[model samples]
Target chain A: MGYPRLSIAEIREGLRRKQFSCVEITQQHLKRIEEADARLKAFLTVTPESARARAAVLDQALAAGEPLLPLTGVPIAIKDNICTQGVRTTCGSRILSNYVAPYSATAVERLEAAGAVIVGKTNCDEFGMGSSTENSAFGPSRNPFDLERVPGGSSGGSAVAVAAGEAVGAFGSDTGGSVRTPAAFCGVYGLKPTYGRVSRYGLVAYSSSLDTIGPLARSVADLAELLQVIAGHDPRDMTSHGSAPDRYTSGLDAALRNHRVGVPFSLIEEGVEAETRRAIHRALDALERAGCAVEEIALPHLANAIDTYYLIAPCEASSNLARYDGVKYGYRSEHFSNLGEMYQITRAGGFGAEVRRRIMLGTFALSSGYYDAYFLKASKVRTLLIQDFQAAFARVNTILIPTAPTPAFKIGEKTSDPLAMYLTDVFTVPANLVGIPALSVPAGYTPDNLPVAVQLLANQFHEKALLHVAWHLEQAFALKPAALAV
Target chain B: MAITLEEVRHIARLANLQFSEEELQAFIVQFSKILEHIEQLSQVDTQGVEPTYHAVAGKIDRENARSDVIHASFLQEKALMNAPESEEGQFRVPKVIR
Candidate 1:
């Protein structure tokens, strides 16, 4: 029998109705990965053995007429950054290439508890530092939409895995558009929850303050389901909020009537490509028709979001990454004379070019002489950005913008120009900086058939409102997943 | 601000990293471009703005603390499983002193 293209809800229902065995569904997805991932390079590691074992146990439970869990028999992929006990969790870098996580992330543990079969760890940028997965030590995950183009990253592999049907759903961490950008490029739904909504205990730290574990799936409902399962307070993470997660799926049925959606017109006027702008405008118009009060608003400080984000994120990254000193864990150099030389050689040899560059940039920013000028200034501007969102949200319930300035570009197009690549995140980073929830829903396809997505931003802990808007838009757009010809 | 090659070298040292002469040359150009881009932030007026260290404001309430019960921790062998080198259940490192 051929593999079925079903949403997470449908898969759950199908299993409940005894239409397919858990092992069968799991095996089909594993086979699909074996076939498609060779070309896509979406997965860094595939755990067929463990997945089969788990599927058999679930199958036995089903045979015994046990009540099914929310994600029973569902095949899911996780971004390599999140730890999975006993599984290799390489954050797309050679530094941790051989490292196996001793403990699973709270999100992963929660997903497994809900009966999700983890198929593999997806690829990502080294330390989640780059815009494209090309910075991955393993290799870039090719965009299923266009093989030559990129699946915008550093969560590119997780997005592609969902888009290409290698996994029914996947989890990716968004530290400034890592999830949303890839979701936009690969034509899927990606949600970056409000910071601290989901525990970050086992996610390999890139930028501790900005990093948030989120979900990517083919539908908004599946995304909501994944978020609801994974989001909650974990005593393991001090930063995780104490409030219980909202029933995200419960708000999916809510109407967008009378909701005010802010459109930062000036933010989109210059940097965004004409096609992407048109698509976003079209989405906004649809929301307006759906009873959202779409209005133009100005967020002048948004122009500097990328500038502020680079400074703060890298600065945090430099400090967070300092633990990899060739002593306790991960890669160490064989040819160093002293401890100091060992550290230098191990880091320089293990990290990729982009990772090293960010480390240098961060080190420079945090260095005693430059701290006040660079890091402090950026932090203050980050406060300004938070104020901008707060002021805008006072008038609007949600803010709408294109997920990226353009659709997926050729793989090598922006690789040489790091600044150009950084600009792709212009629209998505504001939510991260302000600790608000954001969703990237596939809005429309460009003339070339590349997917364009519009982002929905809600104030802190307002994911329900954000998902409500995205659900309505997803229905109106009704974007069919692009066929993976490869 | 233009970063001198010497400054790049200094930053690399601070970051515990080293690069070949060719890599250093490339990094200098790329680093300068990034610095130039970030320099735009200085134009924004941030007077009276407090630096936001955490995205969410306010100290996280430490109430409802999980009772200070010592829970099971990773075994020493499991904890050291990923270490590059281990001796006598301790992570082995290069000599520190002459």
Candidate 2:
């Protein structure tokens, strides 16, 4: 029988109807991962035995007519940066390559409680520091849309797993554009919820101030469902909010009628690809057809996102990553004769090139001579970026932009050019800088058959509005893939 | 433009990292280019704007619980398992102070 790319809702329906047992569904995903993941490199580790064991229990519960959870019997992938108790959470770095989590991340534990079976941990850029998965110690995750191109990073593996049908949906953490960029490149739906909306207790720190865990799936509804399961307050993380999570999936029913969607013309700069420009207009047209009022607006300081993000994220990264000084846990060298040698050997041997690069840059920026010029000034600009979003949101319910300037590019294409790769985040990084909710939905396809994604940015905790607009686009445009029979 | 060798060395020292000469040369170029792209933030006007350090806007409520016992079992377990040098369940390292 040919495999079909099922959504989380469809999988739930299938289990409820007894059309396919959870074990059978889990086995099918495992088989698909075994076949496709070798080429895509989507997973860092595949837990087939554990997945089958968990799915069987869910299958038995269904047979006994027990009450079912929303995501019961669904198979999902997790980014390696998230701690899974007793599972190797590498974060795609050699430093933590052998590190096993003693406790699960709050998000992962919640997903398991929802009866979602974890199929595997996906690959990412080392410490979630790069735009391409090529920075991984393992290897780059290839775009399923085009084998030679990247799937996007550092959530490339999670996005590719969903795009390639290795699983129904996946979890990815976004520091800047990690989830949305990869989802855009892979032709899937991805969301980065408002910071603190999802608990970050078990997430290995990337940039403490910016890191957020979210979902990647084939559609907006599935993304919302995943968000519902993982989002809530955790006492372990002081920054986690006490606000109750809204019924994010149910928000899909809210009408897009009379909703105001804003577009900033300044971000659609000279360097944006012509096809991307056309797709953005086409998405806006779909929104207008769905009764959204589209208006052009100016967010002048938005262009400073990449610059401000680089300074702030790394400065925090330098601080958050300081715990891995070869003394506590993770990588420690055997040849270290002195305490200084131990610190140097462990960091140099364990960290990948990109991780080291960010650490060095962060150290420089926070140094005495450069602190006022780089770190302080960047913080001030970060404030301006947030203010720009606030001003735009006052008039518009949500802001729309292309998730990426272009579709997936060839692997190893931008790995050698760091500046060029950083620009890949130009459109999406502004949301991270501002700490708002953003979702990437499939907008259209390029002439070469690659996918383009349109990102919707909503004000703080306005994920409901963003997902509603995305759902309208999904239904009106029929963005989900129609034929995945293979 | 590439970062200079001296700059890379200075950054390494500031970060408390030791690097080989070959690694320093390669990093100088890569770090310089990445920093250049990040410099674009200098163009924005940010007068009197407050930096958002945390997204959770509310003040934390601490009326719930208090703990006098701090569990050191996990730390002790890890120290026992991986400590290169240890004595009486505590990690031992060469003396840094004179």
Candidate 3:
């Protein structure tokens, strides 16, 4: 019989028991990448030489009878936006296509220090700005389940990599559902930790206030392990809360005796697919059977999440992306009469259509007469949304919602209209807007076999409880593992 | 409110991006629709509400401020490593002076 998929736990146990050499495991995953990445296009960069070099070091340490590190020899992929020293960080855009970071992100530094073998950088939407990885300048990463369908994105490549078992775990940046949507679509567990749960020191900023680096893995335990390594405060990012991270791995087996799962019923009743609605209901039933009480909760301001997110995200993006002019690094356009034209022409040539559109919308929103009307209005609406979540959390232990409105849609389906694509993130954006920890676990599959995920959100810095409930839901859906088509 | 081509060009310019005539025309339509949709923000009663995007505030300034001492940081060459054009270990830019 074929061996079970290489989960993080399996890799750790295998290495500890001397069942396989670290280099051998690394080579196996790299070979898997060579075969799977051909059609999946899940990776922008594959660091076989470096990953092998690191794995060899682990092997030597094992031969010396030394202890293993937390993620020793575990092949992990980073989203292209997160910098790794000397490795290319493109943010999946032509603007920084050839730019290589001089230093690594704090999260990357932490992951490597914990002994994760860096496999490569995965593709992402340019600047983490799109719901689908189709916004990647290089190309869209196809879903491992169906080549014709998209792996839900911005973090689609990371999700694809984990789903296809090319890497045991991966990191993805979530600005507005970048991590969760892809996780849901790819049928893996994804966690978007509370804002500042992990430092964003080296993440190519899309929207600083909302941006977070998160983990995607095939199992809840692996997701917990990955989060344990990366979650902490850094002096570099003051927004990274100074509190110590909880023992996320230990609480996975917690009984759901106190998990008050609240479902925002009316929020999903309209515009959401009937099948997805059924899946969420099914997940609620599983949680109830597992000894958790489920109730209908109201988050009224959630209806305004899309409009609020599009406005605030772009506003912050317009300011954050202004640094990408020709002067510093990255693409510089040819033929400019003067300095002003150089900046304009270079940006025109460098950014993609969606990027340009968002920057335009952002600039317009923050302009002289419109700031109070558009930007400020969106910010205040953001406060109301947070208040809704706050009020709801007071009544319920955690909130449940669909990770996305539907399963993975076809490539090129929503690309024609940008606004239509924006609606897909309607369910995922509120958690970002509220700065809470949200997780997506596979609930069920559609008739076509695409995955549908249910999301759980906990109050700020409550990743422990959030993951605990997700583990409970994950146990209920244990029979359905991530189906690989690669 | 309808966005005009002139306004679209103005914002694009403000954003330091140049758009062609066709690009600007397409943008005006898309931008107008996005603006119209986000106009729903005006319908909500946000009276006396503070405008905030982050649910939790950043740390207190007293705690956030690092010490005034200078510490190790990127050297000039390291900083300029990725620049499209570098001269004398500094990023070279188009001449700004008239």
Best by DockQ: 1
Q: Roughly what TM-score does model 3 have, to 2 decimal places?
A: 0.98
Please write out the lDDT profile of model 2 over residues A194-279, one tens digit for every residue. 98889998899989888999899888889889999998777678777777888888858677777998998766957888878887
Stretches of model 3 off by over 4 angstroms after superposition: A1-4, B58-61
Computed on alpha carbons, the lDDT of every model, listed in order, comes to 0.90, 0.84, 0.89
Candidate closer to the true structure by DockQ (higher is better), 1 or 3: 1
CAPRI-wise, candidate 3 is medium
Candidate 2, superposed: residue stretches over 4 Å from native: A480-486, B1-4, B55-75, B78-88, B91-98
Model 1 interface CAPRI class? medium
Give candidate 3's iRMS in Å, 1 decimal: 1.4
What is the lDDT, from 0 to 100, of the residue A369 in candidate 1?
A: 91
Per-residue alpha-carbon lDDT of model 3 for A281-338, expressed as tens digits? 8888888898988888999899999999999999999999999998889999888989
- Please tell me the TM-score of chain B in candidate 1 relative to the true structure's chain B: 0.89
Q: Flag regions of model 1 displaced more than 4 Å.
A: A1-4, B64-67
- Cα DockQ of the candidate 3 complex: 0.76
> What TM-score does model 1 achieve against the real structure?
0.98
| TM-scores of chain A in all candidate models | 0.98, 0.97, 0.98
